[model samples]
Target: MKNNNSNIKLFIDGFKKFQKKHDNILEDTAYTQQPKAMMITCCDSRIDPSLITDTKPGELFVIRNVANLVPPFEGDLRHHGTSAAIEYGVLYLGVTDIIVLGHSNCGGIASLFSNQNKIKSSDFINNWIDIARDAKDRTLDRCKHNSQAEQINCCEKESLLISLQNLQTFPWIKDKIDKKEIYIHAWYLDLASGTIEAYNSDLKEFIPL
Candidate 1:
């Protein structure tokens, strides 16, 4: 683990350097418009959506969340950052593509498979993670005899499929999909191999992206 004091100092120094570099980009982005393709990815530090896609700053509207799970449309009091971002990207920004990106060795997916009691009394996190609970259950039921790593891999792929299904629950998304104005895609990044696989709807399987 990083020593707290050193980490703090490093963060401050990094921020100082980031300010210098970010200012230039910010100025250019202010005058330029955003891209029409958006990517929803995991919050895992190892998985970078831009790096994986080799996209520039304005090339993709990216949303990062735990497990990259998209919950079904709920008009409740939840923040729904991912959903909101999707809505804005489609409705306001007129983005034509939405990519739900998942990855290997996901901690959130691992937590769903393990006992929930291990986590502290954090209802928000537990509730938020419930979005991927169905994926975990399905993985367990289908891969009952598989190894832990195999189960995790199943969940990772299943989570993307689940999110794709959830995307249809949004009325605007469904409308765009039906009119062929927008396309939804699911992708998986293998951290170890630095390879990405995209879901092939026709083949009903994941192939190299």
Candidate 2:
């Protein structure tokens, strides 16, 4: 309380308002969470799943990371945070839908367009963003005539499709899909325009929703 740090003060002040608004919310969702959908989205500060979807506390189970990329399923034992979350959501939570929420002006997707070796930190980011390598390649090949900005934008959407395909790599997810028990989707948010679009698998394009 003594510290005059604006960021900490902001959180402390904001929590009071949030607490007043959802005083009984904790009591309802404390012991269990039965979210209907699992959303894999970006870690961008501007992207708040609850606020964007206009959902309350236990309505959505959100998993956020760089670019919202989902790596293909692999059996070997390794630290798989995203994959683990997907498994928990699909199996234990019994979420009927898994949605990959991609957004515009994504730093992770933009990094894919640049030369990896040129980046100062030859560490986690490059490795992590590599999950969307295929998406970047597809973007480059398809949007050769477009500007760099356009290519990056194109890859942003392409990356969502790649995530959808990766979701199927999980055997359990595929089984659930086969039985029509669960569905996977790709959604893109244009931050500049404040527009949200859903991927239409039937038409093979993103449509405003």
Candidate 3:
């Protein structure tokens, strides 16, 4: 493994290059962040929402969490990081579109198959991942004959649907969607193929985007 000094140097070098190339872009949007879309995606090291979408900084309001899962809206005072980000994006930032982006080979999603007792030691992961328990159950039931990789892929896509549904559970989000002021979407990123697919509500399937 590389030394921490080298990793820090790599970032410093990369930032120098980025500053030369995008310094003006950053300065233009420094004071005001008026992003048009909000994307809820996995906190996976392999995926960068901005790079994948060819979007620049300030163009996207991104919320990254394990398995890209979104829990149903809860009216409480608890510290809901994901929910708080969504609320800020929609109500404060006025983002017009919300996207739930899921990717292949997600370890977080794969944890759904692990023995619950094994992860009981985890302080928060076990509970956070349970948000997509229904998706895992559906994948197991529908793809029982498939291989483990295939089942994980199925769950990966299905988990996005659950997140999308959870987004609507927020009363403000649902109201905006009903009034046609905001739109919601689900997208899948196939890491192996380097391709993206969007969920078609009318067709009830994912198609190349």
Taking all chains together, the TM-score of candidate 3 against the true structure is 0.92
Arrange candidates by lDDT, descending.
2, 3, 1
**Candidate 1 structure quality by residue, lDDT tens digits, 10-52:** 7799889989876566666677667879899888988877777
Top TM-score prediction, candidate number: 2
TM-score computed on alpha carbons, candidate 1: 0.88
Query: For each predicted model, how many residue pairs clash, with residues at least 3 apart or on different chains?
Result: 0, 0, 0
Poorly placed runs, candidate 2 (over 4 Å): 1-6, 115-119
Q: Per-residue CA lDDT of candidate 2, range 1-209, in tens?
A: 57555568778888899888876777888898999999999999999999989998888999999999999998889999999999999999999999999999998898887652345576688888889999989998999999998988899999999999999999999999999999999999999999999999999999999
Model 2: how far is 56 from its true place, Å?
A: 1.1
